[model samples]
Target: MNNFLAHTFTKKAFEQLASIRNQYSVSIYLPMYKKGKELNEGLGQSNLKSCLKKVHAVLVEYGYDKSSVNDYLKPIRNLIFELSFWRNPSEGLAIFLDKDKGMRCYKLPFPFEIKTYVADHFYLFPLLPLFHNNGIYYLLELSRDYVKLYKGSRNNFRDIPIKKIIPKQLEEVVGFDFEQKMLQYRTGHMMYPAGSFHGQGEGKEDEKKELLSFFRKINRGVTKMISDKKAPLILACTDELYPVYKKINSYHKLWDTNLSGDPEFKGTNELHKASWSLIQYYFETKKREKLAKFISKFHTSLTTCQLSEIIPAAVKGKIDTLFVQQKEDVFGTYNSAKGCLILDSYKEMRNISLLNMAAINTFLQGGNVYFLEAEEMPVKNIPMNALLRF
Candidate 1:
C-alpha cells in the first residue's frame, strides 16, 4: 500500500501549487494530533470526511453532476480509509487536488485551522510560516576530528551527506601529517581554548593556519553544495574554532553566533533546537523593523490597510511586506485586465479569497507575507495591511 503522504514541503512545492491554474482546484487544511487519544481513535480520518463533504457541496454548486463530482474527489475519498496514513501523521495535513492534476498531500510540521477552500488557485497563506526568515537554515558541525552538515527548519532537521564533496575530518585534508602536528599543540588556559604549541606563540599561529586551510576546503565544498548562498549557515563548533573558520569562511550568510560546544555528541534535534533559538531573534528583529517601517509610513502613500488598493498593487509587484490576519478570509473576484475587485459578503461560485490572491502575488514577486493574529496586526480591525515597495 502506498502511503501517499509527503512529510517534506519545500519552496519548490509551494511554487508548484501557486503555478497551478485549474478552475475547480480544491485545497483542504486540517490540524492533526501527532499522538495520544485523538490519533488513536482515528479523529483525523473523521475530520477529513467532514472536509470532503464540504468540498462535494461546493463542487455541486459549481454545476458538477453527482457522478462527475465523485470521480473528481475519488483520490481524496480513498484517504479516509488509508489507515497507515492516520497512524503516522504530522502536526497538520494539506491536500490539493483538481480534476486534471489528481491529488497531492503533505504532512506538515505545523498545525492549521480547519479549512476547505475550492477556488481557481490553492489557498496557501497557512503555509507562510515555513518560508519566513525563520524558514530554512544549514548547520555545519565542525571539530578537529569530525565534520557533518545538516539542513534544518522549524520542526524538521536531517543530515545532509557531505562526504562526497567535503572532507569528513581535518586528516582528510591534511593527511597523516595532522597527527604529527597535533603532538606540538597543547590546550590553553581559556575555557574555549585556541591552543598553544610548546611555549611558543608561533605554535598557536601554525595551528590557526592549519585549521584555516582545513576550513577553507570545507567552505569550498559547502558553498558548492548550498545552491542558495543567501540561506543562513549556522556553525556548531567550539568557540575557539569559530574565529579560525571565520577567517576562511566564504559563505556570506554564515550566522554570527556559534553553537559553542562539541557538536559531535549532539543529535540533530538538539542542534536544531539550539540553532533555532539563536536565529529566531534575527527573524523577530526583522519583523519588528518591517512593522516599524509601516507605522512610520502609515497614512502616507507608502503604506495601506485597504484591500482594494493592496490587491492591484500586489498584481503589479509593488508590495514589499504584507501582514495578514490569521483565520480571516476576504472573498472577492479580481479581473486583472479591468483592474476590478468585487467583494462578496459571502463565498460565491466565482469569488476567491482576495487575501490569498494578494499574498500569493506578493510572494511570487519576491515580497514578504506574514500571517499575524488580530491583536498582532499593525493596524486594528484591518484584515490586511501592506508596506509598498515604492
Candidate 2:
C-alpha cells in the first residue's frame, strides 16, 4: 500500500463530498489569544489547537476536546501532511491552506521557472530522496496530468482543470521507480543489502574493506548530475544500509547523503527526512556552510516580538508571518485585523509546542510552517528562521 494510504480516510460515496464540503470550510484557525483571556491578558491570541480542532471537524472524524487536543496534535507540528482528497481537488486545498496562513499563495502563471528539460526516464531514477517516488507509469501519468491542468486556462488555481495539472518544478524534479531503479537499497539504520545483493561476511579488516567497497559501489554510481556536481543526488536505499552509508558519509571528496531513507518506504527517508526531500539538494551535506546555504534559502519567516515591546509596533500588514500551534489555547487577535492560526503537525521535538506557535504566527500571515521531521533541528540543518525569503 502507498504510504499515504494510511491518511486517506474513506467517506460515504456520492453524497459524501457534499456533506463534508460545508462542514470543512476553506479557512479555520485556533486563535493565538488564550481562551477566556483578552489580547492584553497574555502574550498572544487564540492558539492553533482551536484551529486544528476546526480542521479536524472539517476533514477528519472527531470532535474537539480541549483536554485531548494538545496530545492529539503534538505529532503533526513538525511534519508535512501531504494530503490529496481522493474526492477533493488539489488546487482547492492548496488555496485553503495557503489562505489559512495568509500566505502569498499565488498560483504560478506557468511553471515558468522550469523549461521542461526532460531527462530520459532512467536518468530520473536516483533523485528519490524527496517526497514519494511512486510508479514510473504514475510519474508519466503525473506529467500528462500536468500538461492537461497547468498548460492553459490562464493557470488559475481554483478554476483550472485538475485532470490536466502536472507536477511542476520546485528547485528540481526527478523521476524513479522506488522498487526497480536503484543500484542499491538499504535500511536507514543498518545499511545493508544494496538492492538484490547482501554483503559477504569476512575477517575484521576484510569485512571493513568489503563494506567500504560496497559503499563505493553505491556512491560511485553517481549520475551526471552528481559526477559533474550540477545538482545534488538523492540516493535510494533501505534502512539497513544507513549505518554503512553514514560511515562513509565523507567519501573521496564526494558526499551524497542526499540519499533519502524512509523505512516506511523500505528506502529513502533518512537523507530526505522532514520535507527536506521536497527541497531538491537543499540539505545534502555534513559541511556547516553547505547546509547553511540551503536552510537560509527558506521562502518564509516568522515575525516575532516581546508582547510589551513589539505589539504596539506590529501594524496588521507590517507582519508577514504569524505562527500558532494546533492545540495552543489562545484567545484574541492583536487588534482587530488578523486571524487565528493553527499548527496540525503531529510529531515530537524540543519545546516544539512553543516553536510550533511561533511557527504558526509565520503561517497565519500567509507564511509556511517549517515542516521538520524531527523535533530537534540540528545547528547545521536549515534554521526555520533562515529559510524566510524576506
Candidate 3:
C-alpha cells in the first residue's frame, strides 16, 4: 500500500466542499473499515444507492424529465459498481457529485455519519467535522540527519513516508569537521582558547549560518507538501535546534508548543500522546473564546437559539457562527427555495436530518460552526443555536 491513507486536510479541500452552484448536487458519507477486514460487503454501496433512489423518487414526484434525473445520477451509479475503489479504504469515505459532472472523493482518517444529501447544492455539514474540534493535524519531526511527517488527530496518527525534502546529517552534508567547528564556535570564549582563526573567530557564526542555510532548504521542501494546509504543524527537534528551526520556518500554522526531543527515537503512539494534549488545548481555547463572543451578544438580535428563526436565516445565509450539540441528529426537511422547515420526530424523518441541512447551508455560505457539548454553548443544553451575522 503506497500511502493508501495518505491525505491532507487543506484550505483548498474545504473550499471545494463549500462551493455552491444552482443544480442537482449529491453528497454521500459512510464509515469504512481500513484494515484486516472484508471489503465491499454491500453496506456502504447499498446506502449510497438508497440515497440516490430517494433523490430519483423526489425528482419524479416533482415532474423532472426521466432522462435528466438519470443523467444527474449517472456518476453515482458508476460509483456503486467501482469495486476497485472499495478495496483501498480508510475509516470513512465521502463523495460529492453535481449536475455538471464534477466529482470529488475523500478517504478520511475518521468515520463520518452515514448520511446523504441531494439538493440544489451539496450538503457540507457532514464534512465540517474534519475541520472542527478534534479534527486532523500534522506532526513534523526534524533533525539534521532525519525527518518524519505524520498526519492525524488527537486519538490516532499515521506516518506520511517522506520522499521529498530529505534532511541530511552534518557529516553527510558537510564533513566530520562540521561538529568540531560547531563546538569551537560555541566555546571559543575560553580564556585558554586554542588559537582563534580570526581572533574573535567568526567561524562559530559561520557554522550557525551554515545550519540555518540547511534548515532553510528543508523548510522550502516541506512547504511544497503542506503549504496549502490549515491544520497546525507541531514541530519536534532537539533543544538547541528549536530556535534555529523556528527562525527558518515559513509555515505560519506551526504550533507554539512542540516536542523537545529527538522525535525519530519515538514511536507513532508516543508521538501522538505527546502531541494530542497541545492540540486539544488549542481547540478548547478557540471554543472558549467563541462562546464568550456569543454570550456577549446574547441580548442582541444577532444571536438566537430558536429553531424556527434559525432555519430561515440559515437558508438565507445570515448565520455567522453556529453551536450545535455533538452527535445529536434532528429529523426534518428543509426546502431552501421556499425557506420552509417541516419538523418531524426523529422516528418520522427516516434518513433526512433538518438540523444538518441548516448547518450545511450555514457552512456553504462561509459561516463558522462549532460542534460543542450542550454545556459549552452560550445557551446551555440547547441542542441547536446560532450567532447571526444580521
The per-prediction CA RMSD against the true structure, in angstroms, equals 3.8, 19.7, 7.4
Model 1: how far residue 79 lies from native, Å: 1.1
Of the two candidates 1 and 3, the one with more favorable TM-score, higher being better, is: 1
Worst 10-residue stretch by lDDT in candidate 1?
188-197
Global CA lDDT of candidate 1, please? 0.85
Residue 249 lDDT in candidate 1? 88
Instruction: Name the runs in model 3 displaced over 4 angstroms.
Output: 1-24, 38-78, 102-104, 133-140, 147-167, 172-233, 238-257, 265-277, 315-318, 328-357, 364-366, 374-376
TM-score, model 1 to reference: 0.83
Q: Write the per-residue lDDT of candidate 3 for residues 1-390, one digit (tens) a residue.
A: 111123445556666556666455667777766554335366766777787787677666555678777866676678777777767667777777764546677787778887766556666666676666676678888876677788867545887765645464544456677777657545744333221223344664565567777778777767777734788888877766777788889988888877878888988778898888768877666667767888898889999998878888888899988888877767677676776677777522123566767787787788877887666667876678788898
Report the C-alpha lDDT of model 1 over 1-390, residue by residue, as the tens digit: 222458887788889889998888999999888899998888888899999999999989987787888878888999899787788888999999976678889999888889998887889878878887566678999998899988876778888989779988877877798877675543333222442223446656666677777888999999898866667899999887887788788899989989999998987778989998887776677788999999999889999998889999999999999999987889988898998888998777778888888998998899999888999999988989999999
Worst 10 residues of 3 by lDDT: 190-199
Instruction: Work out how many backbone clashes candidate 1 has.
Output: 0
Evaluation by TM-score, superior candidate among 1 and 2 = 1
How well does each candidate superpose onto the true structure, as a TM-score? 0.83, 0.24, 0.64
Task: State the lDDT at 62 in candidate 3.
Answer: 51
